[model samples]
Target: MDGKKAKQEIVTGGQFTIPGTEVRKMRSRKGDRVYQIFVSSPLEEPPSSGFPVIYLLDGNSVFGTMAEALRVQSRRPEKTGVVPAVIVGIGYPTDQPFSAVRHCDFTLPLPESELPVHPKGAAWPEHGGAEEFLSFIEEELKPEVERDYRIDTGRQTIFGHSLGGLFVLQVLLTRPELFQTYIAGSPSIHWNKRFIQEEAERFAVRLRDAELDVSVLLAAGEIEKSHKSRIPEHAKVLFSVLSELESKGVRAEYREFEGEGHISVLPVLISRALRFALNPGGPHTSFSSV
Candidate 1:
């Protein structure tokens, strides 16, 4: 090959994709705003009725990891104790993190006075799109995916981590019936002076007024307490309150990964998250691996 061609090949390595999975980019417009959306779905055929679907946040990061996890575990379903399911990761189009858009999509709009101390940065991105994003999922994306594949709507699950994990809790608190199960990995519970506690109170009222059967799996690293983020302290409080929600008909439980902290815990927690999501009522208890 020519020198220029060889250099180009080196710079742009061949594209890689997950086997037996479909990847696509889409645009959603409601009002004057348009958000780039990424979706990854397994191409495998479903059972007689349909496949249970998992809607995970940060598609760019977790979709492949989880799709692969489900694929591997389902190979020996009996041995691994996991069932087949579909994974749908919601993400933006750019190779870079969609910081501004995600901030808007994943958080609540609290007044500056109510919010916690601002982080060490100038020009924060526009945030407080939590409810709007939920509407998009309920009204737009869910229907779109259902039209393409036979999904078990009754068995829907959602997973998120970090800020995304905060979003998972938002949905669980606001609309528990939307998804059958939720996996929250190291959620950002410390956000904005901990408004999640108020939200949890609202969840109790919603539970009394509505019959919502939801299962939540909470996972956090043991070291989060002492980390620079100091998030484990907040996360433990979040886990405790979520666990109390069980009395109100929500099946809330938690698993702590030893020796794992913050960023390093996702991979360790994902496999168990998938297994728990597939079999929410199963007696399987804890995950010891770090």
Candidate 2:
């Protein structure tokens, strides 16, 4: 191969190989495109001890932090007694992290006034196709993962942050029964004229009879704000919506980090979020891994 081609290939497959974690690739219905999935095993000796899996969007950015946290949490099963489950990080192909495809897959429809042109260039078309993208997860991606992995299909959680967080909210509203838990961190509620607010309210009202046993955790940095403003209103909105849902008997929790900002809250909340989602009965309890 030419030197230029060799350089591209080298950069394409450069994921860190962890001992306990297994990485594999699967092709979607789209013939040539492939998706990489990473899975980690529990630290315990017995193998049949199936685990609850956490699926995180923007896997490239968050998986390492979560996998490490899971490893640490596994050492002391007493604290986390529920077996340490697998975490799946879903991301784009190596060549396409910044491609226009992510916006299409991650975002819901936005009003023309609120739309941001693709960073690639104004000429590049922006996509508003989250519904189909989510269908891919529901029909293709998830079924393959469940078929291959020894995970507890009943206790899965989907986690997303920022734009990804908005998708999490969408899924919870539309397909509330798919997962037992839904977590949104620093969700971008400003999209589509704050459409998520109305969407959430509709879900609460429509699903009044379901009264889901599912848990929803909304968290944001205490300092989340735009440069034009200093106070973070995202957390407040998250709290208000979840609080409203809670009053209706829908399980929910909201938390704020005193000093964290948008870019810094994900890692800080990883452990706290999992513990709360996994163990909701204890209104007062602290998590300290073995």
* Candidate with best TM-score: 1
Per the 3 Å backbone cut-off, how many clashing residue pairs does candidate 1 have? 0
**lDDT winner among the candidates?**
1
**Model 2 whole-model lDDT (C-alpha atoms):** 0.69
**TM values, all candidates:** 0.85, 0.80
Give the poorly placed runs of model 1, Cα more than 4 Å off.
1-13, 31-44, 208-210, 280-290
Instruction: Go through the candidates in order and give each one's C-alpha lDDT.
Output: 0.75, 0.69
- Candidate 2 at 279: error in angstroms? 3.9
Candidate 1 CA-lDDT value:
0.75
lDDT of 1 by residue, 1-290 (tens): 55665544345667887676776665555533454444445456787778888898888777778888887777656666667877888887667643457777888997766554556756557778788788888888899889988898988988888888889988887777799888888888766535778888777766666566778888889988775556666666767876666666677778889999887898888988877877533625433332
